[model samples]
Target: MTWGVVAIAGVLGLATPLLVRPLLRRYGVADDPNERSSHRERTLRGGGVAPLLAIGVGYLLVLALGNTAAVGTVLLLAGAAVAAGLLGLAEDVRGLPVMVRASLQLVIGIGAAAGLCIAFGQQWWAAALGALLIAAYINIANFMDGLNGISGLHGLLSGMVYGALGAFSGSAWLTATGIVVAVAFASFLPWNLTRPGLFLGDVGSYVLGASLASLAVASAMSGISLVTALAPLAIYLADTLVTLARRAARGEPVLRPHRTHAYQRLTDTGLSHVQASLTVSVFSLGAAIVGVLIPLAGLNQWAGAAVIVAIAVVYLLLPRLRGSRLPRKPQTALVDIDRPAAIAPRVDFYPKRWIVLGASGFVGSAVADHLVAAGHDVVRLTAPRLALMPETAANPISVERALNSDDFDALVRAFEGSDVVINAAGRATPDSPADADLYGANALLPAFVARAASSAGVARAIHLSSAAVQGRRSTLDESLDTSPFSPYSHSKALGERLFLSFGSPDGETDHVVIRATSVQGPGRATTESFRHIARSFVASVAAPGNQPTVVSSIDGLVDFVTRVGGSSGPLGPIMLQPWEGHSAYDVLSAAGGSPRILPRWICTMVLVVVRGLGRVIPEVAGAGRRLELMWLGQDQRSEYTLEFPAMPNHVLVGILSNREDAS
Candidate 1:
């Protein structure tokens, strides 16, 4: 009959979720995973309704069957559990202040304890102890609900202990209540363990805590040993106290929603949610055997205490040992351009499938190479097959095929399953310098990519912009408004605006614009890379002691790419600058040359003469303009500084010098 009641309760628990799941979805009561969340996808919340309903159904059903033994106690305790569950549901809908929430919990806990004391005819001291124990259990259980399957496993394990204690002590009320609590959570476990289906939320956790605490108190008041009541909960108590102490010692905000609990740390140390949950459940089971079953089997108090100490010792060392065994990845610093509060700092990122537009270009190729070398899956989206320049990888789709199709069919086809879509394809130096080409490649391409990325459910879409967008600033800062001095700068600025204005299809997709100063590196050679190359030549030939502007190294570009690309945090727009300022003359001087510093007027004259010569030399004017900008440090220095380790001024220049020497 007792097992039949448990089965009936389990059936109700299973049925409740099927009903509640649809309601939650219809009402949009879902949980969107954030930085502190373990799951990656949004899922239904408030699955606590399952267990809460099941317990209520079981209580009424048992009473209807004329099982009147301890019926009053069962009703009273179950009512308190329902009240606690409602309070948690209220919090889920609209957050309550900590003081209000905690005060309410105290009232419910103390009220249940007092009720148990009166029913069992216990003394005032017993009432006080019950209140304290119940309150502590409620809160500890609440704190322990950080991971998936943990709360359910805890509910199952602790329920079994209380149920067995009730059976042995011959309290029908305790036995029935324990069975209801266990069976309810057992029914909910399948939904939790299989996929990102449902979360217990605050409501479910609160009810679990209240139910378990009240059961413990009721049993103890009914002549069950206090040790037996506490033993099943020993693991939870220890973990909570230890974790709380650690957080307090570190001066962390105790009330904030953070993932720092021992079990959370276990997950961080490479244990899956299932593993962490099972580990805690296993400990709770061991504790029940030593503290409850062994005592029932006539073991002495000292033996139980010794076993508990062993459990505590194992709990203390488990995370540390497991963490040590796991290989640690190098931690990367996450930086936000302006909105620090909006961004989450992280050390590691899940490897993403990335699609690089303009895979043949300098910035595109460099970023694509880095993504591949770092083990991310990469797809190179290039020009049409007939217009295709040469391919290097397994996945290559032409730009015409990716972009020119109707209804974004081809774009969606190419972007499907990509986590990040990077639009690195832009023409900084067009052959014709036509407005149509400039606007099409720089502005329109980014806008199209942003739309496609959003439509395809990509998490992040990055569009590379040039520092030239804030052209000719005396002291360039990230906050500086765009000041396009030339056609190139104007187009780049327009491109940034287009990407930024291309709002997310859903609020979850993030768009980033990277405004980078001159990037000088190998791979796909560009005017910027050649300008730096020419600087080395100028350093080797020019009269010693002359200085020119600062340029960002290939290493600097790669560093910036890694930081921005790997971040699963908030992002908008950022500007990249040189690690430190150095003159082209300084670079040449460092490269074993005594380059004479030319007067500003002389340098201007040289540019004018080079431009005149470029009219005859065809591409000389464009090449000269690029060289002049490098010579003058592009007439801008970044207002915002990247927080990466600064490379020595001589290092980049020396690298350039070595390359120059090798050639």
Candidate 2:
């Protein structure tokens, strides 16, 4: 009969979201994207009302059915959970001051704890401890609710574990309340995990924390061990406390909105929201199991505590471990980008099939590998005699073939049936004496590819142009007119212009020119060269060394390409590099170098002398470009209106580490 009530609550949980979401939307209860937010879109929030409503209905059913066994305890827990939800709802509707919210939460916690203590004939001090625990967890759950499915899954898993423990302990109220909490949260999962996702917001997170804390306290007071009661929430508690401690130690404001949490760091290290959230859930599940077994199997409580501690330690260390691990081999299809948000209601632009030109080259191969890993159908068209060995070659979806760059007909035939064509073919070496080869590869190939893609009915073509086309400008952006300083830059500029000029006669294929800045990654000659320069004894930076330079990771470039290529809507003809905030000194320091800081004027005088020498010496003339890059530093607009993922520091560190490993 109690199980029947749980089932009915589950049904209410599932249906309540459908009925409430429209109301939420009508009321404009949406969570907008912010710097600290995990999600991007303005999504409807306060979805926690579903589970809260379900739990309330379940408790009412309990009373209506005359299931008076431990009814007082169940009613007290329900009242507390509902009260927390109502408080959260107020926060969701009209924001509350932190102090006001905290005070109200304390009041609700004290009342719930005192009532529960009286019902169980426990001491007043026990009530005080329970109140503190309840209030602390309410904040903890709220803090951890940044990612989708995290809070919901935590509640669902924890409720199940507690329910199992209740059944074993023969606590009828605990069993019913635990099951109600479990099913209630379980019902919210679909709303969160699916398309047009809703956030739990304060209301949902508060209810979750309140209900779980109430259950844990109730169970502990009823003879369930404290260790078992806390097992399900151990990870969240550890994450919150450790993060707070670290921030406090650094003298940072603990209340500042920042993405430094363990789970957030995991996503920063390249785990998707789903992946990171599930990781936390997995650890929580493990701890919960250990917690349940201590009492059920008559195992020592201390042993269970040790097991949970181990799990928490591992969970905390995972982001660091993830960074040190070998880079993930490319998968089959381009999956979703690692934006720590749920899917927004937007046009899906993932290409069904792609043709990557010059797939043997560094940037080309990296892009090809990423595409293949993402499970997109990829065709690698390599220059004749240049063998293409993509990182994702093991995948059957990737097709490779040698193609002549000058053969227009052949290029068209190769592009047939593909939705997108990524033209990474170009000559980048500045010192090459053979200007003809540079012109042929950098200037002529793009024109040929663009026309061929259009002729073959390809949907989009992404041409990789160098930022060098803009020369050593103080401000670099896609809007800037090309100012080529050398033959190589001239050729790249011509290629970009030519590629943009040849859209399909029927307007079937769109072309996008990505002006990549100082792109560096594992196995690239440029990366190695930069590393060597950084590690040299003469490595020095202008004082303060804080000027932003244009640097894009190969991984970030691949992600940007996939996003731009897959978009079905019209995009501007030119796009700049997806900027990750790394200055010249930051790049050098990241490469394991401690560059000496020199006075800015001293660096300026050195640059003036170098420029003077450049006119007289042909070899030194090329040094002018390098000198400009070092002293003034090329500053591009770092923020993009287009929602491209920037390469996080952990990913850059991982790439550098990979390069080190290879060497």
Candidate 3:
């Protein structure tokens, strides 16, 4: 019978989103990318409607069965959940004042608590305690709904635990409500986790919080221990309270939308959304299991309380623990460079305010870290939005608007008083099918950034462009025209032209473009891919692989950037780092590959075939480009000089060393 109810609820849960999504789209109920948001793309909100509808229907069916005991309790819980969800839906659609929402929530909480006390014949004071608990959990769930799968997973897991407790304790109302809640939320997971993901908004969180809190209160009033009743929500409660306390201590507005939560911090420290969500869910599950076991095993409730406390403490400490393991200082010497140290001169570092766009990306992160290590006051901006600002900045700017937006006022404000603004953000993937995204990031973003910096009276704007802009060119120099072949390179080329041509009406900012070539280092997917290929059995190079591959060490690039930023006079519009003597063969050898030399003609033949296939297979063209690069590396004129030091061979060798350490 319980399985039947769950099956029906699951069907509704799965189907409701399909019905609701089009309406959401029609109404433009989308969550846009903002400085505080974890998501980069605009996504639909108010997806909580699906699970809310599912739960409501499932509970109605339970009432229709007519033979269930505790009918009043079932009705009360279902009514409370629906009311809370509706209130949240109202808030989501038409924004409500914070006080209005809080007042409404309190009213609902008190009504639900009093009703539950009447249904269970509990004391009046118990209603007060239950109301406070329900109201608190409601907000806690809402606050913790920042990550995908977090709220849904919490609802699913907690519902299952509550249902199990109901079954074990012979409470039919609890059993029916719990199963309905679990199945409904479990069905919402796919919609939340997949691409074009949907957020629950406040509606879903309200339903979940209301349902779970009511159940916990009911379970305790029905003779279950307090520790057991609240176990499922321990992690969420702890996270919200701790975060709020920390903010209050720092004199920050506690109610403001921010991303300082422990789960969010996990992402800042390099964990993907899925990994961080799972980390929290896994610990919550463990704590919930402990909660259930205490009563079943006839252990002291205090013992269970102690165990949950320990779990919550560990979960709270995760961000700090994970951060401590990350590489704080740059590992610049991971590879052994064969070049003379004399070629590279030491740079005298001067501290200045710096803004690194795309600070979450590979090159951007490296540049930001390098700047920070040199004692520069650095501000890191992730793509489409800015994150952390320098502590010294008097008025911190919040550029929460999308980069594609018409207004640049927010960005200009962010760039104010900064010495150098490094535009390191771009779509670097060569074969990505998202043409619009590629163009938006690679071509349009730089122009916008430059305009903003100029408006802000910034001294210098260093835009990082790819060497791939000089496509199919065997010999390259700063003076050569762009010959971009692919969409990626073409976008980069467009960006370069736009950036170099951009001038503020006031002429306050100077623009410099750095064409970085084949940058490789630790923490890069490309470096890892190279390492894997090098270790493969069939790794081979075309004969006479002595062509200078346009490889640049990240360390060397950072060094060059530092020098360019520190230079006093106008250096030039364009700069290219001299080739640090590493050929295709040398790169392979340094990566621990003993490649069998194949005939150059054979490699050419393969490239010809791939290029021919590229007519039907779009991705094959990218492979052809790779083959050509390996066969005939770009030769650049090294005479166009900057005052920066030449990179050492050890910087190149450090790539492999870092790979080994990672393994």
Scored by TM-score, the top model is 3
Location of the lowest summed lDDT over 10 successive residues in candidate 1: 386-395
Q: What tens-digit string does per-residue lDDT give for candidate 1 at 517-560? A: 66555443553344455545453322232334545565566556
Q: Model 3 TM-score?
A: 0.51
List of clashing residue pairs for candidate 2: 331-373, 332-373, 332-374, 332-375, 333-374, 333-375, 333-376, 334-374, 334-375, 349-566
User: Each prediction's Cα lDDT score?
Assistant: 0.69, 0.78, 0.78
lDDT of 2: 0.78
User: Candidates' TM-scores?
Assistant: 0.49, 0.49, 0.51
Model 3: per-residue Cα lDDT over 475-501, one tens digit each: 776643777655577667766765665
Which stretches in model 1 have alpha-carbon errors above 4 Å?
324-663
- In the order shown, the candidates' Cα RMSDs to the true structure are 23.0, 20.4, 22.9
Candidate 3 C-alpha error for residue 276, in Å: 1.2
Error of 2 at 141 (Å): 0.6
